[model samples]
Target chain A: MANQPSIHAGVRALARLKKRRRSEAIFRAFGIAAIVFAMCALAWLLGSIIGTGYKAFYQHSLTLEVELTESILAPNGSRDPDTLRRANYRRIMQEAMFTRFPDIEGLSSADQRAAKRQNFDIMSTSGGPNYIRQMVFKDPAMVGQTITVRIPTSDIVDQYLKGNLNVDVPEVQRKISDRQIAWVKTLRQSGEIKAGFNKRLLFSTDSRDPELAGIASSFVGSLMTMFVTFLLAFPVGVGAAIWLDEFAPKNKAVDFIEININNLAAVPSIVFGLLGLAVLLNWAGMPRSAPIVGGIVLALRTFPTIIIATRSALRAVPPSIRDGALSVGASHVQAVFHHKLPMAAPGILTGSIIGMAQALGETAPLLMIGMVAFLTEIPSSLTEPATALPVQIYLWSDSAEQAWSERTSAAIIILLMVLVTMNGIAIWLRSRLEKRW
Target chain B: MTENTSKNIKFTCRDVRVSYSGKEAVKGIDIEIADRSVTAFIGPSGCGKSSFLRVFNRMNDTIPGCAVTGDIRMDGEDIYAPGLDPVLLRARVGMVFQKPNPFPKSIYDNVAYGPRIHGLAESKADLDEIVHNSLKRAGLWDEVKDRLKDSGTGLSGGQQQRLVIARAIAVSPEVILMDEPASALDPIATAKLEVLIEELKEKFCIVIVTHSMAQAARISQKTAFFHMGDLVEYDETDQIFTNPAELRTQDYIMGRTG
Candidate 1:
């Protein structure tokens, strides 16, 4: 020891110190690189989704002055509701298009018929006709008046106006013909056709026509299913956690139960969907594709997640708190319910919210339960047939239409927003309710 | 040393032993604690002083695989009798831990918890009176009277210990067990706690386990020395400190051995 050189600033020691600093710097660089990579990936995903999805929120529409002929709408001069509903609104729309372009009259009879058909294809068949029917049915006295009304164009025209469809492609391969394109451009130049917010996308339900599709039904279905999932999973999960962590005796049977619970959390979620299919749909004869069945399947998938989280949260409470309560002559139940459970509340709530978010995004299990059906009507009750948002997105993504592709991206954005909001609430609640102890 | 017996004995233990998962922590022992007096159990760490103290209120029962055997009677009633609920026994015999463990609740609620759970107070006014009197007896009323609504965990180490003691006394227990209650406090806090314990012995039988021999000498009237899961000696505090008959007790008090 006496012969050893001074440790500070020695050659070997300095080399060792330099090596240690270099290794630390390398580790820090790797960590920063990892984080930057994750951020870049997230940014790229969001950029692509927004680029395609923002166009689906708006559409092009033509403002037409339609002469609502009383003779065709109510030939008998009867202003009854059923008579007005059964009116020939389609002919009125066709004649209005014919009036806009009277050049069709100069062509041959066969050419005239073809040109008229191409002209009618410029407007949305369902949206425009349904709007005229609802309007005239509500106000029967306006039957003979010529009124200016805005009507959505076809999905192909809407796509072209949004600049998603390329005009440089050959005419044969393009969805829009040169004649229909010419009419659309003419109307746009005259300030008759304009791009506006797509109200149908938010208010209406699923439709074979992409211009009339909406998320209203699927959004409501997701809400109802999440409600049921929370109602069933939270109480049961927290109760089971309390019993296992605080009251259950440590024995072979309990150990086995605990092991199985952990294993259950890791099981494939679609297996739960199959269980629901066999027991709920086939055996119990519950309605297929109903939110109740969907909710129950999701509850089974989320239950073990909630249980694991709650057990860990309960374990996090220091043993001294339980001992303090017990020493004061509080019963085991009172000790757990009064002191420990309250302390574990924030953690349990955060876990439950995260689990619910996972259930919201889950699609595979929902598919097995027949929630992937193309439901058009919005469900009014738990037992009614419904489809969830993720399932709706999956269905739309599988469509062979460019408009459906944009709609699918938009639906994905909405689902992501809901998940982000739920996660945000979980973070906010954890911070707000967490105690220092 | 000559046996020092009290006519008003509160706890009588015969061949009492405690084990955890078949490993004995506290071997067979016999001891009697007098009512309305302070008895101190002093030994080195892990000598089973705390385990023996926990046995009085059945706190050890909460530990998995921990078992206590033999006869332990309180006021001539077998506390381990089949019909005697541990919950009721705990209310009658309260315990304070080595670390101050006040619940994360208002000061009033912390003290009112015991009485509220035992139904000792019937109304809000009754609960308030009980909390007030308990805190006053625990020597914490003057310091915390204005902050009854404040969280009990917000107090200092000394105050939290006193609040826990007040919580124990609120249920009107006949015996209070303290397991090294002042070991975590500073010198000044320890002095304050010793004074509070002195004042409390006038009403309830107090049993304490301490690592500090000087503290045991200063605050306890009777002393029990433990070593390697056995009680080496039990006598008057003055006799144990001055004229202990056992070699292990002498070595321990003389600071020659742990």
Candidate 2:
């Protein structure tokens, strides 16, 4: 009976081990599922952004050949460049549309005007007029000449080409009417309608017309703001970090400062915006809506991040390293600068770059400082009015247009690309500076 | 113990006590370290043997909240004098740690670090010669001569330890302090290092702390026994191993107690 009880205890122990092993396997599966789920979520987000945004990079346009008759443009019959410059370019484009659709020309005068207006609406709001003005400015000699040019189509037609405006939908519910769809089809069949690289959308500033809008101004703004943020944050952040980490004594005041600095990093970013408004704009008398102010505000927000990163980097340097240098007769300053700082450099630089990237995406603080203004020109200096890429994306996303949605997603793609590139550089730099010991 | 050795004293300590954060680590002790000899301190763990060795070079000064008392003089000069700079003092008394802590640099740079900081060498050629001689003295010159540009950390543990020794000697210090220098080495490397230490004693005052009684008896000229932060006994290596003066020292050396 004693031997039997011992054998039974052995079986019970084996059963308990089996139960533990099963739970371990289940935990392993859960971990793998969690990782797969995270990866799938990220992939899904990228997939959707790419799918919708790629269409914005290329736009549909209708190519046409039309006579720029002097009667509609320079009605005075004088080829004076000034008069040509002052000519009615929109009417010339309308006449070109009428020429393309001669059926509209055969209609009665009032009906003809209506048909002409409808045809003109099919062209891009700014591309047709802007193209005429550019040609006239480039060559006054082409006033009476017939030139073939490609002009952007309207957003509704652009949507139709991208299959966003469904033809299967009821005509009343659709942005494009049946007749307009038939005209688009005819143009497509005749090889006149084509998809062209959207140079205007890439080059132009913010516009009410989605087809004419671009992020050029905001890209420059982000560059300038981030530059200023870097200039302010890097030296000050690193200096403060070095002092606090290396020189500060372990007193209650220093301890309190360290705690507050960490807490500052976790504070809501919008609170920084309010502080910037009160300090930089209201009290300091700095210009509002300027990149300089935006940069300062962003620096304040990113300073804590850089400091935290730098202190950790400094801490990672082994105390044995300082001991080695000091043991070799190097002074405290010499040991830190010659050995400790160099060893800690890669980590510091990586942290600074990450902080800069975070500053690049910040928008709420800029909004409080009036960077949400509809800036049309690219900023050339720190003191100029500017808007960042994320703010531009925000502005476009708020517009009530089908094409604006695509542009919004496209801007998001660019932001993500820049962020990825920055992080890649940080990783590369870290590896380059990595030491085995 | 020796009839022909010079009567020069390299270090003299009187009532030296060291404490960390108000906890006394090394109780009051008095000792004199002779010039041009290897003096070893042997004790059990937490006996403050390493702390006592660090007093010679003022290496204990680096630890925060570590307070040192009493008088420690090197070559008739008070090390804790008001006008003395620790940096210059360290150059005079170089140190090698328990673990080999070579900088994350090439072998040549690791040795050149001390000479460069002290400005001991005037030109590149002088620095090169110093590095060569130091490595030679450490018995590491031949193995690393072809690969001086390789990282110091890339070497084997024993090689790295010898490299650290070479780095310490490059500063041309009068006294070199080593803390458990051979505790991490294998039998062959330990034998090689013990031989190097004996040879180094001809030119520099060497103070070493060790855990191995045999190691102390083999290389050191004099051995000091410590227990619980107090010096139990100190004498010539032969007398301490064969005929200890204290009961605790005899018990420790006989492996009867610690």
Candidate 3:
């Protein structure tokens, strides 16, 4: 031991300490890099979504005063509902458009009607006619009254107003022609067109016209499907966990079951979709594309998640609590229900919420169950045809039109908001139910 | 006290053997416990004293792979007979563990758990009276009277132990078993618990397992010495402590051997 010099020993110790410090620094650098990478990716996703989607919430419209004449609206000069229903309100809208632009009226005979029809097409095909029909039906006596109403502009004009169409691009490649673009500029200068809240996009359901589509039906469908998923998964998962962890005898069969349950949690979700197709749809003959079928598929996918969570929660409760209950003359069932289950309830609830959130965002399984079908009407029952929110976003993106892409991003923003709100509720519930041992 | 000493036998064991997964933990033995008295079982660590005590109320039945053979009877009925429910036996014979294990509930609820499970009370008022009497007997009513709604876990170690005792006695069991009930307490609390046990023996038969021979000598009227899973000596406490019958018992009592 004395052969080595004291100064050499100190130098060696310092060299080892320096090597350890260098490794520790490298580990810290790797951790920081991982965190920064994640944050940057998240920020990029949100920024792109918000930049493209903000315009879809607002729509551009043109205001016009239409003179409803008795000769065109009520030919018989009668107040009958059938006569009013058959009235030629389309001609009135055309006349109104002609009055707004007198240049079209002064054109020669062959050109005048054609020009009028071409200019009037800027308004939504259904919006102008539907407005006049509603007006005359509500009050038949006012056949000559002039009323002012704002109507949605054409989809291309709306996109142009939102700066989606580049005026700098060559005229051949641009969707809006030079004449239509000049007219839109003149209308804006005269204060005849303005941007307002898009109530149609918020209130209406699926539509063939991109300008009129909304997610109301899909939102309702998602709510219904999630409710069913929660109802089926929560109680069943908790019960299975209680039985396996507390009451079941330790044996070879139970050990096999426990291992299989863990493996089921890691299985690809689409496999469950195939299972649902064979078992629930084919064998039971359930209706295709219904929220009930979608919900059942998602419940099967979420069951393993909840079971694993509940088992760990039940295991976390100390064994002394069980002994305490049993020593006081409680039956096995009573001991579990009274002492162990109550203590594990908060953890179980948190797990169920997380499972439900996962089910909400799942798209691949939903697609297999035919939850991606087009639906226009809000579902009134579990058996009705429906599409979920994530499915709506998927369908809109697939079409890839001018305004549909914007609507897809808008739907994505809404989905993220809902997910954030659900997670917030789960956190609040956990805090409220947290107990000190 | 003298009159209570002559009470009839409350528990009878004959050739009782306990095995855990084919390995014997307690060998065959015979013993009788008198009613309304305190019997203490003292032994070295891992000597099967706690296992033998668990056999009285069939608490060992909850452990997987544990088997008990031979006759153990209470009130002239075999405890291990077919159709004999351990639940009923547990209700008749309550237990308190070495460590204080009060349920995560209010003080009133902790004392009320046993009676509630056994359906011993006719009304809420009846339950309240039973809880009140149990806590008073356990010597915790005066210290925790006003905070009946407080959690039992909030109490000190000694108070929590007493709360468990109160909970056990709430069902009005004829026998109460304690497994090193005071080993966790301080000297002052241990003295208080000894006094409470003395008082409790007037109404219920008490069996206690202890590692402290001084504690066994102080509180128990009869003592059993266990060594290496066998009963080395069984006699009156004074006789066993002063004049041990077996060489192993003498060596153990003298702190020379285990």
Which candidate leads in DockQ? 2
Per-residue C-alpha lDDT of model 1 across residues A1-437, encoded as one tens digit per residue: 87877887588989999999999999999999999999999999999999889888988899999999999999999999989998889999999999999999999999999899889889998778888999998899999999999999999888888887888888889988888889999999998999988887887899989988999999999999998898898898889888999889889999999999899888898998999899999999999998999999999888888999999999999999999999999999999999998999889999999999999998888899898767788999999889999999999999988999999999999999999999999999999988866
Between prediction 1 and prediction 3, which has the larger lDDT?
1
lDDT of 1 by residue, B55-148 (tens): 9999998999999998999999999999999999999999999999999999999999999888999899999999999999999999999999
DockQ of all predictions against the true structure, Cα-based: 0.82, 0.83, 0.65
- Root-mean-square deviation of every model: 2.0, 2.2, 3.2
Q: Rank the candidates by DockQ, best first.
A: 2, 1, 3
Highest lDDT against the true fold, candidate: 1
TM-score for each prediction?
A: 0.97, 0.96, 0.91
**Candidates arranged by TM-score, highest first:** 1, 2, 3
Clashing pairs in 1: none
Worst 10 residues of 3 chain B by lDDT: B1-10
Model 2 off-target regions past 4 Å? A1-9, A77-85, B1-3
In model 3, state the lDDT of residue B36: 86
Clashing pairs in 2: none
